[model samples]
Target chain A: MSNVSATLPRKARVPIFVVLVLVGISIAYPILYLAFTAFRTRADYLGNPFGLPSELTLQNFISVWNNYGIGRALLNTVIVVAVGLTVQLLVAGLAGFALARYPVPGARYISGALVSVMLIPSQVLIIPIYLLLSRIGLVGSLPGLILVYVATGLPFATFFLIVTYRSLDTSVLEAARVDGAGFWRTFLSVASPMAIPGLATLLVLQFIAMWNELLFAYILLPNDQLRLITPALAQIGGRFTNDQPFVAVGLILTALPPLLLLSFAAKYVMSGLGASFGR
Target chain B: MTSPVLAAPVASASAGATGARPPGRARWRTSERLVGIAAVAPAVVLVLGFMVYPVCYAIWISFNKTNGLSFDYVGLDNYTKLLADPLLHKVFLTNLIFLISVPLVILAALVCSVLLYERIRGWRFFRVLFFVPNVLSTAVIGLMFKSLFSYRGPINAVLAQFGIPPVDFFAGAGSAIFVIIIALVWSGFGYQTIILLSGLSAINPEIFEAATVDGAGWWKRLWYITLPNIRGVLALVSILNVLYTFTALFGFIFVMTAGGPGYDTTTLDYLIYTLAFSSTRLGEGAALAVMVFLLIGGLTALQLRVFRVSEEN
Candidate 1:
């Protein structure tokens, strides 16, 4: 092992190995550029695209937040995520509980249909949904976007939670029942404890998806104020074609929320969510 | 209350199998059914009304020839026209490019996960750092990368540092494809790495310990032990990644190149968006949508079958 490590020749010697590393760096360069330019100034950016910023400044970050008003976009994203994930979790949880604990006729059929929904693109149904929402005067509202988010989120969440609830030992529920617990009581006390990891995983995954969604939100919400971070950031491109630093800071900020949530939720997301689909 | 409504029918079905429905049992079942329906009715109604109903309406509209909203049934003409467009063929080819990128993503993800999994220090920080891009919305990432790869963008700047000539990543077709590839790889690999690492972490430590005790080194342990243990997860992640790649968002291409440098990045998703919204060829877009759905469904089914075959071993 020591010999193999030593003979590795301090950074690849073979021609093919050298070529592969070069290719890897080539693939990686743009990403590195994004990181590097975050600190650059407009003059430096235009004059020398790849050189280190002549002078470091936090001015771009401030401009991205204050001038571009991404701070509000970030707040709106939080509101959307909080409401969307809560509604999704509650609705899916109740449905999954019924399917798992109660005798729901055609449960298999309902589950199958929901799973099938996962296969279809949002494009096919989004237009009609738009027209329907327009009829009810929800074309440009935060609540309207939340409604669409919940609808889109339901199928996968239900499928996931049902599998999770079913896989738990039923004896725990029976024990609570023997101790005079009713259905909701047993569920709240017993099943939910064992299912927290699954619930957390779903929340993280769905939150990221909702937070990152652009198409429906862009189409459904016409007002710039109601626009989520995605469409908002997209609009920045219209006015500033050459402002690379602004784009860099916006990209970094936009990436922050999901990265933070995913980092914390990584352990649960893997073990809990991955386990449900194993069969 | 919802449970009783939803469960009644199933309970009754199970009871019917025993062939004795007593009066009290029937009354209780009736109430239970009502409760159960109430519990699940919200989600069911939403799915039916929003998802199923919209799809039905859209499919119906595709058969007709109208503006975004009007009434005219020009049956099959739109479909015929859509089939004849040379651009439709381009869209199919673009979709093939989308399909081709998936393996590259999976291979990169597997490599990154293994490298990061070597009981190394600062594992958590590196994992988070790598995954940072996955959380960024595709539109933002797309927008940022568009600038980054443009003629005066930092990518060209960096090449100059190594005494190399500046390359116009957006000007030429090959370089344009490279830009899209970079964004696709940049945005995707992080998520897969996290998932793959989880799979790696879940392998029973005892298995590795056993391999080590038998004098299995890193390569031998990885080849003979780690790979086999995470096979199911590897299949699942690959399937998920393939589906994600197939549905490459219009947002990225729209922001980055706009399928530009002369239509170099016109994947099926981008083409479908254009056909529906831009070209007003709703029927063709619908056809394209159906094609994407079928392709993803076929791949997912294949994945499941492969998974099952491996499990039997």
Candidate 2:
């Protein structure tokens, strides 16, 4: 170990290590506090919000699940994520392949328009969408919320998939075409397989984003039954007012899914960003 | 899906009929082109409906006063009101103040990325640890900070341990902004770091090895090699980091101070949210939204231009 450390500049090692560790601790501290507080009682939390739990309890989580409606809200969130992810993949994937492979007229403009849509912040669009949805009676519904998610997730998905499809071996696609594979046939046989990695990356990114999306779900899905996890957890915070442990429990439930997702796909997430920006 | 796969072999067999190939293949290609058009139709329609049409409608909304659902043409009343509204001015001012974090976070991320790029001990673990806050919901981080900086919370608790009285963290505009900025930087560091790490990894080792052989120190190598190599990624991240700070500060500000003791922390995004929903002033909100959109659009265009030019150099 001492020999290995000798390769690095001896003078700077200690400060560099300390800085990195400090950063790591700063990042981990709140998360640990969030988790620890969830396992403690209100008295325990109020007495020492920063301290480790002397006695652990599951009552807060139980309350969060039962009264805070986290289970129902989680189900709603899962539905939104599921539907949004599926439609986003299908639409962006299909469109991306078509534009990349076939002579789709106006494909350039369509692609450019989609990418440019990212410049418009979602908040700006929400105002008009709110009005439009109200007129169409999409306000306060799960589908409305899902539509917003799909639209918001579309730009990145389509952009990534287009790049993915474009970078694929064109000669192989050519061989497929010579074998009389039509658009759908060629896409399934060639493009879809290659787009899977990009799609998976987009999936993890979108799942986290849609799961955590509060503004649209708050504005569009005003119905309690359709409320997604973030807003619902936020509501639980207010509903339980200073019942910090329960809210902490709610926060844990809200965070745990993405934590699981990231653990499984962190490498792909980073690589995907590299792919998107490196181009 | 099954039928498309099955049709492939049949179509191939038909195409292999050499004598009739010209007409048969032309017909096949025409149908293929049609299918391609059909494939992209849904996404185009979605963009048209959700983004394009809504933006046009929003422009009209900005020109009118809406009493509930119906609109009365009030000309540029809402637009001028944006200039007159003190809160609106303050919202833009707060956003400007918040913009200070964009470059700071980028620099911090660049440093962290460079450190990780050094293949430091537990680098992978550190990267993931730094990203932990980002993977969680913003509301979670926001609420965490909200609770952490409360008068009786852990931060004050720690301050008291140092023989300092508990500071009123959210009492003044400056301190409230301070806490929110800390939270923003903490929550966002992971993403920018990952982007910069990607940039770092893209740099060729030969150049760095040559620099090492030339007796150049660490800072020299980073300045000459790493910085120049990652210019594209830096530009991209800088633009994005600024855009994020402008729009996505909502969850943090909303939870931390609800725009604060005096609307000091309310960004344009949050202000728009409040005006449209909280005050039910949709017209004024729509006007402000359009202004914000144009502002973002202009700045993004300028950033792209600048980045593109530097990328050429």
Candidate 3:
């Protein structure tokens, strides 16, 4: 039961910060190098592989974005991330709200089961889900990918929201109910607003997960026109193997959305992710 | 996984179970039960439909052979085939080989977190910067590394700058797997650090203050008080890493080496992907998947046992 202080002498902090700088550079260098190189032409890269680009150019970015089917893939990604995330938040949110606030007999068991199922390694389910989706002819379709994403994301969403809702005060919900609001009204209005911070954090995290999810997207969406952004980027990389600048640009385009979002909302991302791991 | 935080909720949850007395509490309990049922039904049905059902069906299909249009029941045949297949044996060996990297990852994470927890300057910026890699798509990271390690990439370019001969990183099995391990640790280091740092952040500073007053130096205080207190979280992060080491290597392998240089980088998950989709041997692939699930299950059970034992101490 001691205090939570992290005090250090002035002289000691310098060496520790040096260590921090070393660790930070190693973690950040690959990403920064790739991004920086994308702004260069192949000749520029050959001239200096490790240094910043001599002259910035958007040619690589424009070429990859317009020509490599990234435009179509970006649309497909939007459908999956937007629609799939909505379904996940809705289903997981409602279930967590019920389990947290309601008195259903089997709710606890269901909540526990959903959370436990998340521990099941996903590769095992890939084969069967592929077969199932193929049998129903949902393979190569956006809806099929969305369904799988929602299913996979449900456990985390439900698990996190349940913990979040349980930790929330119930007095507001009680007041809303006293005003003659029905269950849906109370939950949609009171509980959800109170949980907005958590909800937004989870939404961004889910977006990043789906935006970057490649394996399932690879297996499910095999059709050329319907491929998502990640697969699109990977395919272009393989196609333009000799053109390092092209591949670099493709990687940057694919990585940009999440990196930008994360940079802006790092607080939410860190806190949300920390909350998940802490549990 | 069996920590008091996660485990304690189970007992209290049963208090609101069904049958809150139909006669006495009938009026109030009706709406509550109805809302609860309606609320949870979606998640229950979705999980059953997607996750639970598919897993069970996969186990069932593990016993049969299948072509595009036909299926034949072959009880235990798939398992027997998997058992005797030399490639799978190689895959298991490779998995063991790759596992040597897990502890290194944990150590890196621990060092970073402990330093940050010691009030290192700009730790917040470093944390966010480090975490940027974790958010990037695996394919992006994988392909970037693949290019960076290519014969003429920056790595070799730098080597040549130092007057060293050019080296083919992916030309040999050892070097290829080495690259894969580096990518594995490099990508994973950030996320694990953030988790471990949070665990460190939760530690009471008074513990350190008291120790310092008693003439304990930083290293001694870290070794004795900090390490022992976060034993639960260390176990948690390591256990989670076990699962990732087992399966998550697939993305990196696919983009980086495609398990090349004579199947050197192929893990069990990668092997299953190649078998099922590449070779179109669904039965054998399904069989391998079941084995992976069992291995992960055993690891999880071990995690819980360790977590619970630590709780008692």
Q: How are the candidates ranked when ordered by DockQ, highest leading?
A: 3, 2, 1
> Which stretches of candidate 3 lie above 4 Å from their native place?
A1-7, B1-27, B310-313
Q: What is the DockQ of each candidate?
A: 0.35, 0.40, 0.57
The ten-residue window of minimal lDDT in model 2 chain B covers: B15-24
Report the lDDT tens digits of candidate 1 across residue range A1-279. 112222123343343244334434654455566766777888887887766668888889898888877888888878988998898888888788766665455566667778888666786666667767877989888888898889887888888888888778877765665687655776677888898878888877787788888888778887877777887777776467678788877776776677677677767644544533421
Query: Compared to the true structure, candidate 1 yields what TM-score?
Result: 0.82
Q: For the second chain of model 2, what is the TM-score against the true structure's chain B? A: 0.87
lDDT-superior candidate, 1 or 2: 2
Candidate 3, residues A1-279: lDDT per residue as tens digits? Answer: 332334567788788888889888887788888888888988898777877788988888888877778888989999899999999999999988877777655555766687688877778988899999999999999999999999988888898898777767767776766688887897898889999889999998888989999889999999989989898887876677778888988888789999999999999999898657622
Q: Interface RMSD in Å per candidate, to 1 decimal?
A: 6.4, 7.2, 4.1
Q: Write the per-residue lDDT of candidate 2 for residues B254-303, one digit (tens) a residue.
A: 66677778787789999989889889889988898899888877888899
What tens-digit string does per-residue lDDT give for candidate 2 at A1-279? 112233358677778888899988888778788788889988888887667778999988887788766888989888888998999989988888877776555556557677777666777888899988888898988888788778767777777788888888877877888787777788887778866787788788778888888888888888787778898877766556467778778888898989988888888766676645421
Per-residue CA lDDT of candidate 3, range B1-313, in tens? 1223332464367567654222223445566766776777777777878898889988978888985347789999999989998988898999988887889889998988888776555768988987887898878888988888887789998899899997899888888888888887888878889888878878877778888889998889989999998987888888888888897888888887788877878999998899889998888898999999999889889888979987898
Q: What is the TM-score of chain A alone in each candidate?
A: 0.86, 0.93, 0.93
